[model samples]
Target: MEFQQLASFVEVARLLNFSKAADKLHITQSTMSARIQKLEQELGVPLFIRLGKSIRLSKYGETLLPYALQSIQAMQKGMKKIEEQKSDQTRRLTISAANPFAGIFLPPILAALHTLVPEISIQVLRNTGYSDEMYKMVMDSQIHLAFINNPHEPGVYSEESAVCLIPLYEDDFVLVARPNHPLTGRDRVSTADIKPYPLLFMGQKTSISKHMLRYFEQQQMKQQDKLEINSIPGIKEMLKQTDMVSMFPRLIVRGDLENRDLVEIPMRQPAPPLVTYLACQHDEIEPHLLKIIQESLARTITELGHPCRLFAERLA
Candidate 1:
């Protein structure tokens, strides 16, 4: 009948002593006897054969033992499942990302994560500079995951290391300026052509700046009138008001391009595209969560209609 009644029946049957079964169940002997008596009354059958000092299962009790055991086990399993679900509701995950991903990838990925796993909470650490630092965060277990750029570079850790890098997309740094800017209508604009105008740089430590500088070094050219503005929005606004031009990831500038506020200046020799990676320590994240992140990223890219390919598809 009741859970305690069934439980008392099983325990009393196993021990063959009401006092021992009561002690084991942490109840009084009278309480245990009451539970067993109630169960027997409900079934309309005597469960125990009482022989003065000794007791054993009656025919009815023998038939009910297996079913009682199964009922207790099922109840326990159901309780455990409820506890696990409650635990999931309170579980929290922390992730870090570079500035580019903070703008372009993070918003959609977060929306998707909420839709898929609404029970779990997410904390984001944004604008954590460079691939090497992001890689270190994952390795040190300071964060569950990181969205970084070009972790496969010379100094940064690789897939061969403890960190696993899942490539999400590649964004080429394009020279962008206001629509009415002098360089906008050019068929072929060289770095030499870009030298005269003020160049807006993100930060000396950023991947974008590093890659842009590397491209300049390779071309054996330098811009004299450089203005360093660490903020992307700041750089875009400055471009709108002034003749200054900036090299930015195409993905980040998609909206500005669509609105005709900024136009990509065709480069004769463009800087190499930066590869964005989802980095995590091996077995650090649950497989289901990782799958959700990957699916979210892929879906976001598809919805944005960005010309980027997922690493798995690239390998295929």
Candidate 2:
């Protein structure tokens, strides 16, 4: 079968949606369907089971997924190598990141990348999308890497998967308020300290919100007296002006903390961890380049004085 057909199959399976896969590949939905049907016919098995508006991979599709990814990756690498030979002057690296991480964490990582590969050109896009969407983009080679906060169960995809999700660090979610707020600069503040103030919350779309709700529940606190704000900067600004406090990944508020603009309320030990991962298509990037990027991330995390430990090291 042609590489295009296999590529189409992989994208559809990865996204679990025909229209999105088609949009990603810059093809019409009909064209996408034709490619998948052609591939399935050639294989003599239906790759996907269609149930009304929903679709899922069949057993055969699951078996073919990894191999299809490898084939497309190999072909793409071969093409890229040849193209690099013809135009060796510069190389481009593209990355996507969700909102707050994009602003708070990427600058240092990008700086490190620049230092490591001075001649490379870089493009950073704001993902602000679901982790599944970012996963599809990375799989399709739309972006070379992604910084994502995934709420999926850990260990579902480890080093063995075609995609490598190297976790940079995990930060405990903490409550924060403005500098002069009664809770500011305190080593720790209890849930009782938090109850009297109006609370702000992230949208439920994010894992952070789920953790926050659970934590609030555990503390026997009610979040009904809260404002829902999805934007990180918006939350930060609101905290500065009002007596409201909110939960956040400590890494995102590092600057505010250092500037004395915010403070974390003391919570009991062993808070819920918000893990940030560096995801890449393992087969798409050269091993050595991946190593350099990984090392840069680790070093940057340390330099920034974050408490996150590398996931691979933990496994070892």
Candidate 3:
């Protein structure tokens, strides 16, 4: 059982698709299959069951999943330590974030990090998907930390699963309408009333809205039309011109909230809470990273301020 075989097996299981695993590992599909088959033969159990072209982990594979993930992570850390010694000059700390949180707080965080930790540098990856993908990057040692949305359910390779989650702050989803909208004055707007406007929605592929979309569909309110934009700013822009209402992160529009540029229409049903988090892997905890993580979380409290204070606190 070579480290390469275990690594390939883990990757295949994580994605549940051989082609994606192969693409990620920079290997051909045939090579990826051979490695998984070799690992399976050695273990005397089939790791994956093919359904048409897609793959799912079998019961035996499920039992092995956790250990396979651990083994690969451990080996990667060992290799990273050796590489860290060779570099000697710069300390590498990587952070991945989905679009909403990243765009809002990133500049200040980056500026603060550079000023305080001049000896270290940061690599930031913009991810619009679920927190699970960023968690895998930490497990693979590609990133030491991530500024992410907390997962609703526990994850297999989530850094938050093992290390810690210092939730910086939380925010609620609210409808954004232009300054003069009649609905904003009301104490609560009905889902039925929201149906009348041109609805602008963020894509499900983004961080938190994917989870929120299901709840939205359940209400069964029909909008005149659907405009699927990718960012909070884009949604805000659309609302400015037309009577399009959007469900969005409040943190994205505080300036508009204060000056009455965009009035927040409070909802009948409460919005789902989104906690911005600083997640780190347990075993690879380094001194500078811990310091930076602490500093960043503190800023999320102080700088990002009350837009987050509205929800709840889960400090790690």
Candidate 4:
């Protein structure tokens, strides 16, 4: 029944010589015989055929060999599973990011994380609506870490939320127009030029979107007149047909910018850059999640690709 007894039984069965088995097990011959006898007694079967000084296995002993080997193997397997689960429970890093966080930033970070900590599992809350929702989730202990682009909304800097935002990078928002737009031929456009068409504004919940509203407020343009959508893809799909130009974090549209699917309209106004940050609960147990977030941000900065003169001038 006990592991020690099982080990002794296995050793004795392997050698089939009581004296040698006793020596291998670091016990006296009498002690080894008593343990084997005890095992036979516990199972209520005669395990050995005593032929004077020598011995051999009985039918019961043969059957118990398979059972004992299986029991030991099962115990080892059970212990291994427990260790893996414990590592996951403690080593895990849960990240919640808005949809814009998904495509470019996370992939390289995830690949590097696999190389850094192969045992740790990461859970991503993708297609999420905004930082407010992510903030709520982290406060509830639903997620461990995130890289949130601050919603330029009111109350974002307040202490009511049990979260801390650390600045990682500042990304500018660009007016993204599909190919063949009437204004694509222009060198630059004024804020006045942005309001006439069905503009695909951000869902009002995000800070990036709120910043858009802020830019309009500063420009004194009435964006409330144009079409608005909560989701990014919805805005992109709308732009495929309508004259609706959408805005997004520049890091997110790097591929589009390169391929010309989305052209940056070079707005010359003093617009605020979206401050992308690493956010977490005030009390997080696993500290490794922060490393994962930092490493991911570094990868994001590298992949941003040949920072344009516009980025340098606008960021300045």
Top-lDDT candidate index: 1
Query: lDDT for each of the candidates?
Result: 0.83, 0.78, 0.73, 0.71
- For candidate 3, the TM-score is 0.65
- Would you give me the overall lDDT of model 3? 0.73
Off by over 4 Å in 4: 1-89, 118-121, 155-157, 229-231, 283-292, 304-316
**Clashing pairs in model 2?**
188-266, 189-266
How well is each residue in 238-262 modelled by candidate 3, as lDDT tens digits?
A: 8877788776667777777887878
lDDT of 2 by residue, 1-316 (tens): 9999999999999899999999999999999999999999999999999999989999999999999998997898879878986777787788888645676567876887788778878898776545656766776678888887754635544455567776766777777888788877667677777788988877865656766777788778765688889778898999999999888878878889889898767765435777777777764456555566667667777787877656653221
Cα misplacement distance, residue 91 of candidate 1 (Å) = 4.9
Write the residue-wise lDDT of candidate 1 on 194-235 in tens digits.
889998888887878887777888998877888998788899
CA shift of 21, model 3, Å: 30
Q: Which pairs of residues have clashing backbones in candidate 1?
A: none
How many pairs collide in each candidate, listed in order? 0, 2, 0, 2
What lDDT tens digits, residue by residue, belong to model 4 across residues 71-130?
776677567758967766646778767646666667777787788778777787674757
All candidates' TM-scores? 0.65, 0.60, 0.65, 0.60
Q: Rank the candidates by lDDT, best first.
A: 1, 2, 3, 4
Off by over 4 Å in 2: 1-91, 118-121, 127-132, 153-162, 179-196, 206-211, 214-222, 302-316
Better of 2 and 3 by TM-score: 3
Displacement of the residue 291 alpha carbon in candidate 3, Å: 4.7
